[model samples]
Target: MLKQNLQLKLSQKLSPQQIQLMKLIQLPTQAFEQRLKEEMVENPALEGGKEDEYEADEFSSDDYDEYDEYDNDRIEADDINIDEYLSDDEIPNYKLQANNYSDDDEDKTMPFAANVSFHQNLIEQLNTFILSENERDIAEFLVGSIDDMGYIRRSITDIVDDMAFTQGIYTDEKTVENILHVIHQLEPAGVGARNLQECLLLQLRHKTPTESVDLAIDILENQFDAFTKKHYDKLLQKYNISEDQLRNAIDQIEHLNPKPGGAYDNSNKAVEHVVPDFAIKIRDGELELTLNGRNAPELHVSKDYQEMLQSYKHSRDKSTAQKDAVQFIKQKLDSAKWFIDAIRQRQETLFVTMNAIMHYQKEYFLDGDEAKLKPMILKDIADLVGLDISTVSRVANSKYVDTPYGTKLIKEFFSEAMKNDQGEDVSTIEIKKILQTVINEEDKKKPFPDDKLAELLKNKGYPIARRTIAKYREQLDIPVARMRKKI
Candidate 1:
């Protein structure tokens, strides 16, 4: 079948520059700075820092649309014009500076101290133990198997088979288990324990055996399920202990480090610092929003590159090599101009979007109250700012804003609307906050279940279902009422 039909349907397509702009908009402060550095490195014509006063003002954001006119078609050397790039007009001083930060602004960068990793520390401790070549290899293998949480999650038989196959060490389960016991004796009290029960027992074993410590060990070993489930009456019946004695044993168990490896220096792990893209401050009972200075990096096209283009334009020789070189120079210059313009557009979009959000949730920002946050979605902000919903989402998803309360993810401010008893719309965030407050204030010995929580919220005009309460509770990271119960 042969088909050659002219299609006449209106369709929209994103230009390369538009695609780039969307990607740039999605990046948070830290990632955006990294992208900026990469762009400067990849495009030599794109220079960072302030441009000289004498440089041409040709690469303004207004000229960004001109980049679309450039095509891949072959160009004659005579067609190139140097006058377009070279001009006596000076770039505006305000355009050159970011003006986001002042001299008085404090540096937010934190220095992390390097230290031995958890596994490395264990290996060093393994060296201190006087083991034969085979035992040492088994021990090292076991140490490698230990996760960051300081637990050997694998079974003894699994380790045994792995050693025989991977390490070429034919060893039995008993031998591996024996070597594992040696690993369990390492520092941090419970580095090599297989389970929580084992981990707790290991820590208790290291402690100078008090009645409470011994009792705690017995509770963990004999009534491990009952202890974890907080079955106080069952524990009392089984242990034949008084309330105070049981309480002391429970306290001792609670004090033990369930995750021993967590105490070790985490310098080996990649540290992620929260560099907020926007800062929302209350200046004289009014909300003030400012983008991070790092986001507004001073970038300009290289003047020397422009000069090189000019020199090439004036030269009499119009060789193919010269034409190719000029084309490359023109491409780089266009790219630099587009990138600079993209950045400028990104800054404007971010500021404008965030400004709309700030004003939208003005009550929350002014008083630092989560309950004051209005029911807002991406479309609401998009409609307000006259941008696409996807664009608003891109800004909301990855960006963090520094607020008077704390650094908050921008998405946190947006929540689905729910009607109260009075038929007034309210944010789900407000309901969650209130729900959390109710849960926090409830009696630990008799924590409110989902149904009771629903009733309580209903009394407070929320009228949420039992299932919804449970959902919200789970979302808040609060366990079930049974899990929240105390001795």
Candidate 2:
């Protein structure tokens, strides 16, 4: 069935200027430094450091008309169009270059590239393989289908159908399977297989066989679910293998790469260093917060554009076209002024909110102790800063603060508090910390059950329910007592 409908909807949306301000307000210190540089490169009106000490009085907007006429003549001589220039637009030559690491720095150069771009590597290898042009094309296309984790998300049927429809090439399932087999034989060994079983088998085929290797393959091929779910008792009974033998076989299987694409990660190199946006230092028993100054470049209005506007205003003027030019110049200048003001506002707002957050979490920042972190939410910060909750959340989400303790995500400071048996409020993070400690010390042969954990917590004054304990355990990715059980 087909349906058509018309509805009128009214929505309040931020203008480009407002949206830019919102983004600016959320940037942390280091990011703000980069952001300022970007604005300096982009908007001529937003100067980075300071205005010139001595400039002709004619540089002001009041003389914009006179400058415009002079600029118009020069622009026409140069065959440059005025329409291409915007008051808020950045100059072309001042692009910010990414920081390059010096070779002398040991951490800067790694033994292997940080991330292995597997799919790209496979395609490169496929190019070296001896194949007919058509076979090469097909193999390349298949290689392209593999993802970073080294799995072909699409089915073979879907791929064949796509090729038939788009490329007009008839590729059978068997040919695709053969190409897949060859791909699996590549360095990573298990990349192109359709399922886990195939992925494991491809890796196993390369290894020298042992008695347990064959058994492990059988276990993987037949009872993969049981093996994965840690149903060791059932498997031991089924195979009549002792626990030590089973462990060895499991180790052998675990040694295989499930995704062949994983191997390529070391060979390819694209890595970025973590840049903390805010810096905090304690001096004279007070914490001082500063936005990183590196991100923003000093910007100023281009003298040429300023001169054009000045000249236009100076001319008592003549034609309708000249009047129109004057109006256009005024509009662009206004836009540029508005953008500069918004950026300034964003800077002030970011400082105000960040300062409040630092003060609120002063203990944690000073000590680098997670236990010292007070329970806080967006509303608490918004209240302190006299801003909206949403605004506070935005600031917290993207920003990072470098404390004496360590660089941490700003959001790590915020946590919901729960009331303990003593009626004292405690952060969920604190509870989680205690829970982790309890589990870490528990006997491996008989791990504490969730109910038992809850009872222990209650004895310690938390008074949480068994269900709450279970939920917290899951959040920590801790298995149930049975799953945690060990020989």
Candidate 3:
């Protein structure tokens, strides 16, 4: 059954202006400048300049009531009337602040340069190989199928089918495999292998053969599982080699690059540099925070647009054209003022939010010590600044700050709290730092397992379990102790 009832409800929603401000707050310096330029292009009444002066003339409320007749961006032809507006000499007043960056301030140059793409380099190398036209087409098609990691993700059969249907060139898996063998011999030494094992072998085979190389290949091909699991005893017995020789062979394998595509010089793509939105400096044992002025843009209403509104007011006929002009002028003025005010509020919010973060992690800022970083969350800063959690999140998500230690993403300063054996709260970041150091310094011949790591931390006053240690290790992108083995 369908039923209807009347009930009162209270709901909250963000205004368009608020939404715009939120978006502006989240943008890093580079994106923010691009956004500012876009707004200036769309809204003629809004502009960038060094002028610091602004003035306005007041208008009656009844005059503005006429604007309510039109929908947003809709101007009625018949109902439009200018008889109610002011005389030729008078102009409408608006609320606004002058937006400006200094004309004399020198612009900071961003560091970037183009690099050759990985696929393009491979194609150029393929061009050097002499082949029949059909062979060349198949080779080119195969090269195109390779991924960023320098491995062909598609099957040879799929490539063959694709070449038949899309490229109108039919080829079998054997022909594809033969050509792939040729690509395997490319400069990267492992450019076209199907899997990690094959990739490593390709690189090793390309090098001049030696006793150590032969042993490494035997280990890789025959005892990969044992070698990867660090079953050292089984490997030593099977290879009939002393621990020193196995270690040397493993070292040779370790020197080979696994991610061959990463070895490519990406000179075609500009090296992107993170431009921090904030900077923290220490003076007189005090922490000072400053917004990177490089990212901050000055915005103001266009003076010319304001003057045009005034001009329409004087010597204006009570025609639809004059009313439409007034409507357009008024809309632009409102947009400009609202945008300028939103920018002002954005600056205030960013400062308040980041200042709170700076103080929250004050100890770390003072000493540049990861151990000193306190456990903080988005809600903590949001509550302190009387803002919504989402607002604080947007500010922290993409934002970066330059500190005494080095540049860091704003969110990197936040960590969950964990208690020590003494019942004192400590940062998860500090615990991770300690855990990482222990792993890095452990004897690689026999790396510390998670349980052993937990025990070690427990001895050092951290109350953690084996599972917790494993979780932290995974978060740090470190594999298990078995994978960390040297030989």
Top TM-score hit: 1
In the range 10-75, model 1's lDDT, one tens digit per residue, is: 999888889999999999988998999999999998787656466545455453335454466666
Global CA lDDT computed for model 1:
0.86
Clashes of 1: 0
How accurate locally, in lDDT, is each candidate?
0.86, 0.71, 0.79
Worst 10 residues of 3 by lDDT: 90-99
The alpha-carbon deviation from the true structure for residue 482 of candidate 3, after best TM-score superposition, in angstroms, is 1.6
State which candidate has the highest lDDT.
Answer: 1
Candidate 2 lDDT tens digits, 1-487 = 9999999999996666667777777765556667666755665544544345422121223423323322344333123223333333333222222213232445344454344366666777776677887777678778888877677888999988887898887889888877777777666777777777878887887778898788888899899988877788899999998988888888788788776665567446455456776789999888988865443333444455566755655556446676566555544554555455565566567668889999998987777778888899999999999998988887788777778888888888889999999899888999999999999999976889999999999999899989989989999999999878664
Model 3 misplaced stretches (Cα beyond 4 Å) = 1-5, 51-102, 110-113, 265-269
CA lDDT for candidate 3: 0.79
**Alpha carbon lDDT of residue 400, candidate 3?**
92
Deviation from truth (RMSD, Å), model 3:
4.2
TM-score of 2: 0.76
